[model samples]
Target: MTSPSDPIVLVGLPGAGKTTFLAALWYALNHSTDGGISLNALPEDQAYLNEISRTWRQGEPQPHTATAVFQEIRLCVRYDGADVPGELVLPDLSGECFQQDQWADRHWNQKYDSIARAASGVVLLVHPDAWKGSPRIADVARAEQLIEGSVAESQGEHVASGGAGRAGADESDQVEANVVDFDPLRVPAQVILVDLLQFLIGDPCFHTALRVSVVISAWDLLESRGRTPSVCLEKEMPLLHQFLTSNADRISCQVFGVSAQGGPYEDPRVRQNLLQMDNPIERIQVRDADGNTSDITAPILWQVRDRVVEERECRGIS
Candidate 1:
């Protein structure tokens, strides 16, 4: 049984819809004009909390400019037949953080190491696009290099390691050392992949033994492509299941088709422009980005809740 102090961490690549998912879940949980979840809250950095609250209140639908800024929310939830106040910490780091060489270094890894240890488990968000592209060889190499470098540095054997037992070396430092020692080749414990509209298909062996959940975002686009939820899932499930069975004997994964946008936007033209824009600066064009009036909140929240419950069951957590 997790204590009220335990928190859930959402880890994903940038653009994997982490923020969107969090926002949707936040709106559902609060369901009030006052905004924000309050119950037996876990302790958090007050200044950081205030910043995120302010940003959400501003209510602009702009994409995040930086992914390194950590955003979190706490809620009083009923779990295991008990009221346990839990926190959800969503790091602002982009999907790139997972493979970025710069942040894989000692300093960046140190920060993430601390956060990772504090959380009960992680919800890793991967992009489906990753499966289509030629496996990211460069990214793999970079990650390996970073891991080696971090390990060496933590052990005071790397070229960068100098000061011995400095005041800065403490829990966070120890955590960093532990993470540095981790073998990246192993599968993550809990992972979720969020695709714009694609479902997990092709192979089940790819996700064997791991608890996996597939989030299909941008449901509106699937309709635009002339597909229904049932049709999409039917086409994808066999492949996903087959792959999982082949890869791991103790795997539990599920497919959930969701639409972060809920439905087609009121102004289709704006959606077109936003989708077609290749440059972020170009996206600022007033003519570009249109707002939608569709209420996707209910459906999106349902999927999230279901997935949370499903994940808990899969992990044998009541």
Candidate 2:
């Protein structure tokens, strides 16, 4: 997974907090040198991520990435006691562009295909605030209800026509009927996501590799509203969660909560919290909402260790 051809890509829709995660990950890697994980990028490579970290620390939202523009952010990484070093390439894409690629007349991009195929793994950032489930869930439920009602009304007619049920099954062994048409108002976010997963998964029978870290952005906001990240994901992006989880054979998935800037700058205490969390040695330090630092590097380490283990397993090495 550390090969130049195997970059760990960070992917998400616009407003899904991809920028925030990238900035936060970069900052943690650079600032927290003691976490058994380290990042060394050239000075020229440092400028972009550096500025992003700075902007985020200043309490302003980083700009969303522009559509159709592909930039590769690569970093050399080392764990304190690892035999080999690794390089990760983060993807540059806007949510709109991702959406467009999924639904735009099946248009193909050579660059996207190559990058995805070559990816070592992926970090899929998700923002609860940005994803509100489609109206289709309710629509589907209503349709199901209508279908059941109509089916009940036609039961006698079906029996008279000798079509009481599906052929060759016991009367008591009824199979559930499913609606063929799930009338969605617009191309749903999940639909796009499903298509993207299909593209990335590449093979229908097997997944060569797909490591996904689900970072729930603005975690503090969810906590403030008395919600857990898991609950938020279940409520808001259940389809994505279900889709990813269903493919456990190929997709190694994990969920984490991180508040990069802690809170927005508008909050009077944000600046002070940054002051404390800005400790040079403790890059994982994240300020509390009330403003005290806590560790933010554990999730990254989890990814690293998981990647190492999986890569070794794939190679059939003990």
Candidate 3:
């Protein structure tokens, strides 16, 4: 029951694989089988899809999206067993918009705000390798102690040495040199994700019971650990896990582990292996909450509507 204008927002930090996912998605939908989601017809302008999909299929590394760039895609999709087709508007915003403006400075652009209001679901991605450790009380306390100790040492030098305060000034300089500059990039991915979700919760225009698909992109890097996405979230990002669990009534959240490239595309061996596959589309990998491998559209379908079961029914799968 999704409208043409109600978008499924794609949110993620830089290098979290949004563009790559879009490319893979475009290819998957176009080549989807009888019981899978597919486009009713090609878009009027397939340039964007064509270029990106080409890059993806070639196993080339996707370029980083600039802050000012935006790509909005509208697709008329035919879901299995649905009588009428549905339109899916997916807005691909720069990750910098979320990192610098929203999470860091608390400034939401008017256009983004409007888009968020009309969003029926969200696909938020977090790359496993991009995680910066969350802020810890012990770390904060250690920083405070360092500052306090520096202040005490400076005062002692001034009072005892009485040497024109040069020693105190030098000590102050040392302390300043030791302190690291505050950069938004240093903020933990989970912390920013939690903040984004909290903003959505506080927005009166945004609906409660919003479906969110939290995808752990670059899941291939962690697949050897033998942990599911939910378990990975709980262990790596306990705060976010707890928040989502507590707000389950307001937010319907699912975790997915997706390997859009199947492996590091830049690696010769990996790229060769992917290229050797009979179908290039087989390079995309998606694992649902239960660790079952699924189609790339599975997460998107779940977000837009609970069509996973319907898809199974149409396929006549038990």
Q: Per-candidate TM vs. native? A: 0.45, 0.71, 0.82
Clashes of each: 13, 2, 0
lDDT of 1 by residue, 153-235 (tens): 66574224665455246635766877855443222212222221112222232232334444445444454565444345434
lDDT scores in order: 0.41, 0.64, 0.80
Runs in model 1 deviating more than 4 A are 1-5, 32-60, 65-67, 72-76, 79-81, 101-108, 117-121, 126-210, 223-251, 263-318
Looking at model 2, the pairs that clash are 14-95, 288-292
What's the TM for model 3? 0.82
Best by TM-score: 3
Model 3 lDDT tens row, 1-318: 434236788999888899998988998887758325789878898898888888998889877887887777888887765555777788888888898889989897787787788787889998886655565557789999998897787687677868647876777788799999888768788888889988887778755577889899988888889898899988887778898999988889999999989999768999999989887777777888645563788777777556444445565764
Error of 3 at 293 (Å): 2.5
- Give the poorly placed runs of model 2, Cα more than 4 Å off: 1-5, 41-43, 136-186, 203-207, 224-228, 266-300, 307-318
lDDT of 1 at 92: 48
Best by lDDT: 3
Ranking by TM-score: 3, 2, 1
Residue 3, candidate 2: alpha-carbon lDDT:
42
